[model samples]
Target: MPFRRKLLEQTQRDIKRLKNKGHKPTTLLGIFLYGGTLGFLFVVPIVGGAYLGLWLDELIAGYSEHWTLNLILLGIAVGGYNVFRFLRDKT
Candidate 1:
């Protein structure tokens, strides 16, 4: 169909444009390294938040898990934002 041909042509053009924009094909090792880095970025904040919360809880005494839970949630939010920003910037 004419429509299908047009779509294919557009897709090819887009691919060409992307290629011209310095988008090199990535290797498997690069992908794995990116994945590992992303995972570390997402996890470090969470662990740090948990540790800080635990320390705060120890210092405070009465609330117990209140600080820990709140900080963990905050960490997750921050980590998600961080990952989003990283991906956005890289892309």
Candidate 2:
């Protein structure tokens, strides 16, 4: 069998196992919390960073150039590090 096929088979098996385990309320809640946190972890930083950059630009009002870009890059670096850490833990 191909690698993809094996991966799919394993995934189905895991799903079946979870279902067979009775899908307790706590288990479902845990899954939802994990998924929600993952989503927020990925999205919040970019949106918050953009807002912060815009606010900073307004406050400084041309005292220095490229400040917004610098803040955006910092946000990207932080978000990228988080994603890297998540993937590292999975592997």
Candidate 3:
């Protein structure tokens, strides 16, 4: 009986704490906007890297995709890092 009473009191306190925290509810529009921003952040770096790689390849008279491939890979790494940082900070 004593243990059950203590448990009930603890549960009430937890409920009170949660109610006081005042967390805002998430909306559908907020979710969509966040998704769109995340996508844009991810894509911009990759495309920029591809474009830069292509330009570098064109500058040199070589029939090789070395620059393009390297830059694209670099871009992927950068974009992944950006997304990771954004999410970490957001949370």
Local accuracy of candidate 1 as per-residue lDDT tens digits, 1-76: 9999999999999999988878677899999999998998899889999999899999984769888889999999
Ranking by TM-score: 3, 1, 2
lDDT of 3: 0.89
Model 2 Cα lDDT, one tens digit per residue, 5-75:
99999999999998987755567888898777667666767677777877787888466536567777777
Clashing pairs in 2: none
- TM-score to true structure, per model: 0.71, 0.49, 0.72
**By lDDT, who's the top model here?**
1
Q: How high a TM-score does candidate 1 get?
A: 0.71
Backbone clash count, each prediction separately = 0, 0, 0
44 Cα displacement, candidate 2 (Å): 2.1
Of 1 and 2, the candidate ahead on lDDT is 1
RMSD of 2: 10.5
RMSD of each: 8.0, 10.5, 6.7
Candidate models: Cα lDDT each: 0.91, 0.76, 0.89
| Residue range 1-91, candidate 3, lDDT tens digits | 9999999999999999899767768889999999998888888888999999999999988686888899889988888898899999988
- What is the RMSD of candidate 3? 6.7
